[model samples]
Structures are given as C-alpha cells and as structure tokens.
Target chain A: MDGDTRETIREVAIDLFSTRGFDQTSLREIAERVGLTKASLYYHYPSKQALLTAIVSPLLDGWRAVTDEAEGMAHTPDNVRHVLTTLLDVMVVNRPLASVLLRDPAGVVAAAGPLWQDMIDVATRLTNWVAGPEPTVAQRLRAIAAMEVLRAAYSSITYLREEVADAEMREVLLDSALGALRR
Target chain B: MDGDTRETIREVAIDLFSTRGFDQTSLREIAERVGLTKASLYYHYPSKQALLTAIVSPLLDGWRAVTDEAEGMAHTPDNVRHVLTTLLDVMVVNRPLASVLLRDPAGVVAAAGPLWQDMIDVATRLTNWVAGPEPTVAQRLRAIAAMEVLRAAYSSITYLREEVADAEMREVLLDSALGALRR
Candidate 1:
C-alpha cells in the first residue's frame, strides 16, 4: 500500500521476470525476493498479471511521450538521431522493465492482449520517427532495424551484462542504432 | 504416422503457433485445425512441446549448416554477403517455422531449453562470420543489428503479411539486412 513497499516489490519482480522470463517466474519468487508473504504482496498487487500491468503502465506512458514529441519533429537524419537517442534514454532508464517486456513479447501479447496492442501502436509511431514521418520501404526497414538495436540496448544478454557501464553502453548503442538507420 | 498426415499436422501447427503464439495454442486447437481427434494427434506428438520440437529441429539443423559453412569461409564482406544471403534462403524456405520460433522466443526457451541454447550458439557463430571472426565492439554491435534484420525477414508482422510476394519481400529484406552490416 505504501510507496516504498510497492516500489520494492515491483523492482524484485522486474529483476526476476527480466532474467528468468515472465512465465518462468512466480509471485512467490517475487515475494520471497521482496521479503514479503504472498498475502501481503497480494494486498498490493492481486496477480502476476497485475504486477506486470503495474510495471508496464509507466513505461508505456514514457514511450507515449517520446512518440508524441517525435510527431512534431522534422523527419531528417538529425531528427532520427535525436529521436533514437531519446528513445534509448527511456529504455536505459527502465532497462529492467524493458528487458522483462521484451523477454517474452509473444507471451506478453497473449496474456495482455489490449496492452500489447497499445505497445504495437506505440511501436508504429516510434518506427515512423526512425523511418521518417513518410518512409519508403528501405527506410522503413532501416527504421525497424534501428528500433531493434534500441530494444537490444536493454533486452539482449549482451547489453544486460555488458562489461561497460550503462552510461557508456548507452552512447555505444546509440551510435550503433544511428548507424543501422544510416542507409 | 504417415508422412502426409504428419506433415499436414506440422504445417497447421506451425501456422497456428506462429500467428497465435506457442503457449497460447493448445494441442486440441491444432488437432481441430487438422481434423484429427486429440487422441489421434497425441499418437504423433505426445505433447505440444513435442510438436514444437519436431518443428524447430529441422530449423536448428538448417541454421547449423549455415554456421558450419560460414566457419569455413573467409571473413570478407563478400563472405558476409554470402552468409546473409544463404541465411535468408534458409529462413524463406522455413518462414513458418522461423515465425513460430520468433513469435514466442521465451516460451520456446522455457519449453526447449537445450535446443534454444544450441540456437544461441549457432547465432553467435553466424554473427562472428558477419562481423569477422575477430570483431571489435562496433563490429559486434553491427553484426547483431544485421542479424535482427534477418530475424525481421520472417518474424515481423509487416514482412509476414507484406502485400509483396515472399520472393520480393525476400529481396527487400536481404537488402535491408546487408545494409545493416555495411559499417
């Protein structure tokens, strides 16, 4: 019920879910990690689905902000670079949550159908920013590839356990993402 | 099981699994699609996991072949081109299986743990070929982004339902993939 307990529960859930996968993890595991009883955890979040819904809600809001801001920006290479950088910032700040989300996109889609649809809509808008507001097929493909790089920034095993600090990896990944959209 | 019936079941299962997702799909659903009783379907594949294993096995083999070949070749841009082109061929030949595999990566990882590990190993080998056997950090990142584009060749909703024929999409996707690696 309190902010501290809820935040702690959410963090532990995200850590377990991101590494082991959403299905492989359970509320008990999260509660054990958070040092809470199942009933106590349920008092705050009723279900695993509810916990995930709580985690993703704010992430979706951040993504919405990026996409909405991108809509008013110019569709130039500089714009693409700036957009990808901003997107990567959001993903990195919420790296654990992003990993949990990306870890099992299809499972998430099945479990949270309406939420997944919202994600797809946000993705569509984000890709438009990367590919340009009006993109050719090649540009569209490039945009998607660049987006994958941003997804990889947090989601992939490489980035998740990178020897480099998150700050350095962010710059490196941003460069790679911009390079992907270069063509 | 007869070859015809087994192949038909596999095809229908792949179609359903790829579109709907592996976990969400039930054995009964697959059997219904194939006009078979659950008992009859169980006679071939004891479980949905077995069906997926049967489907992904050949794909794993194909990937193995690509990685093996790339291992022998020089790490030139031309070789990277050849490897990606060949990878695309394998993907196109087994688009449905690729889609199924990509659609629910985490579910597949959970249900088919060792098999998925083998896939990650193969992917690592393949990326080495594309990024050069001894790659720098940037090369490694580019290799991954390029691989993501190849993944897009089949797994993405856009390419999966392109108004363009599979052949045309293949070419378009191939170009996009090569472009990703052009550091």
Candidate 2:
C-alpha cells in the first residue's frame, strides 16, 4: 500500500491496458506483473473498472478544470486562445491516457459510464462556452469543430505515430483550432 | 420479399436503431414494427448484424467511393475542397444512419468487424491523400483534424439535435474542415 507500489501498479496497468486493450487485460495479469498477489492488488484497485477509473481520472479532471475556468472567462478572442492552449497542454500531458480511453470510445463509455459521461458533459460545456452567448448557429458549429481540432493532439499519436513533436502538435493544433473558430 | 418490403424493413430498422441503439434493438422488435413475423424478418436480414450492415452500407460505400476517387485526383487545393464537399454531402445524406452507427462506435465495430476495419482503412487512405504526397508531419496532422471536423456532419445530430439544417451543416463543416487544413 506504499506510494511507490501504488504508482508502480498504475504504471504497469497503463502499459498493459494500452498494448493489450482495457477489456483484454486482466487484474490477475497486472498483479503478476507487479509481483503482487491478487488479494493485495484488489486491496489497491478494488476492481478492473476501478483501475481504469484511476488511470483515466487525471485526464477527466483536467478537462473538467478547463471547462470550469472557461465558464468564468469572457468569450473574447484572447480568452478563447488561452483556453484552447491550456486544453491542449492538458491533452499533451495526458496523451498516454487518451490512447487508452479513446482507442475505443464507446467501449470506454460502457466500461466507465459515469466517468465517460462526465467527460462528455465537460466537452459540451466547453463547446457551449466557446460558442459564446446568443451565438449564431454557425458560431456554435465552429466551436464544435474547434474542439474537435484540439482532439488532434491525441489522434496524432495514432495517425502520425510519434513522428510529430509534442510542441509542434501543440502549436499546429492550437492554430488550427483558432482558425476553425476564426471570424 | 419484394423490394418495397425490403426497403420498408430497412427504414424501420434504422428508426429503431437510432432511437434505441444498435445493441438494444433486436430483430424481433424490428419484425414486430415492420408487421412481419420473426421468420419473415430472418428470411431477409438473417441476423440483427446483417440488418445493421444493410443500414450502414450506403454510408460506408459513399466514403469508400470518395477515398477511391481521391486516390486518382491530384492533391490540389481545388481537389481538397471538392473532396471535402463531396465527403460532407455523403455524411449529410447519411446523417440518420450515422447516428445509429456512431452512437456506439465500438459496439458497431464489434458487431461488424470487417466493415468497421474497411471504413478505418478507407479513412486512413483518405487522410493520406488529403495530406498529399511526401507530406510533412504538420500536413498529416491537419489532414487528420480536417477529417475529424467532417465528422461533425453527424455529430451535429447528437449535439445540435437536428437544429442545424443539412445545408448549413454542409456549408459550415466544409468551411471549418478546409480552415483546419489551411496552411
């Protein structure tokens, strides 16, 4: 139950989950990899779903925080740019977790219902805020598209396969998102 | 079955699947709604999966056609715009089917593995062609983002709840996608 062991277990679970898939990877295998008995592993994670929740919660928390901040800010061009930049930073840091969670989006939704719902709700809020008050239909569509452009941060890992630098991804995607929302 | 009955069945199935979900809808329910016995329905579709495949094949075929056509065209800006517009049209026509298929993407992938993989491969080819020959990492990333923007054609149904007209969805999403790809 020490911090190091907990972190090690989490690291091992992410590796297994990403390579082997969330459903395909078993808690038994995770325990074996971490040299812990099944009972001891359960003591930490409780269940496979719990382990997944632990793995992806950071990304969810980051997105929620972004939405909360956006709610308070004026929907000015500069503020929109700042919000997008921070959101991209969150995605960049959580790219590994995104790989696990978004690899099969519906599967993640089914496996972790509340967590996935929270992420969806956060995205909807962020999209609404970006759309601004009394936004035109076109403005709302641009906001949705802009949010989707930011998703390229993680999708680059799948499509380009580590060929693009993280900084380049941040820059290109941020600019592209702004361009998507351009007046 | 006659062509009219067959088409009617497909329409009814799409309605049920979109509202109730692909996994939640059963062949028996579709049969009941279509006023046919289960045996009669089975005679046509063979399984719920077959019905889904029948429902979504048009969209998949449209996408595959776009990819195939793009394969021959030079990756000029004019061609890119044409391709995006054509892709948007395909999505617009298939918005209802897109709702059924994309509502639970992983579930559809599981239910129709080969069809889903074929769609993914077609998407990759389209992305590559859109990226152009000997593309830079940044160019490839933009191609991916642009493709994601085009996805809003269907996602608009989920988010905007049919408030955005098909014409508006086509116009705005095409513009946003091009903007995402703009250098």
Poorest stretch of ten by lDDT in candidate 1 chain B? B155-164
**For model 1, what fraction of the real interface contacts is kept?**
0.28
lDDT of 2: 0.82
Give the fraction of true interface contacts kept by model 2.
0.50
> Which numbered prediction scores highest in TM-score against the true structure?
1
B3-76 in candidate 2: lDDT tens per residue? Answer: 58888999998897776566656677988998998899877777878888998888889999999999999989
The runs of at least 3 residues in candidate 2 whose Cα sits more than 4 Å from the true structure, single-residue gaps closed, are: A1-42, A111-114, B1-52
Give the alpha carbon lDDT tens digit for every residue of A6-92 in model 1: 989988887887777777677778888888888899888877778888988888988999999998888877777788888888987
| Full-model lDDT for every candidate | 0.76, 0.82
The interface RMSD value for candidate 2 stands at: 2.8
Q: Write the per-residue lDDT of candidate 2 for residues A1-183, one digit (tens) a residue.
A: 455888899999888766555655678898899999888987877777888899999988999999999899998889999999999999888877877764445445657978888887888888889999988999899889998888777666656765777788888898888878875
What's the C-alpha lDDT at position A80 in model 2? Answer: 90
Best candidate, lDDT-wise?
Answer: 2
TM-scores computed on chain B for all candidates: 0.89, 0.90
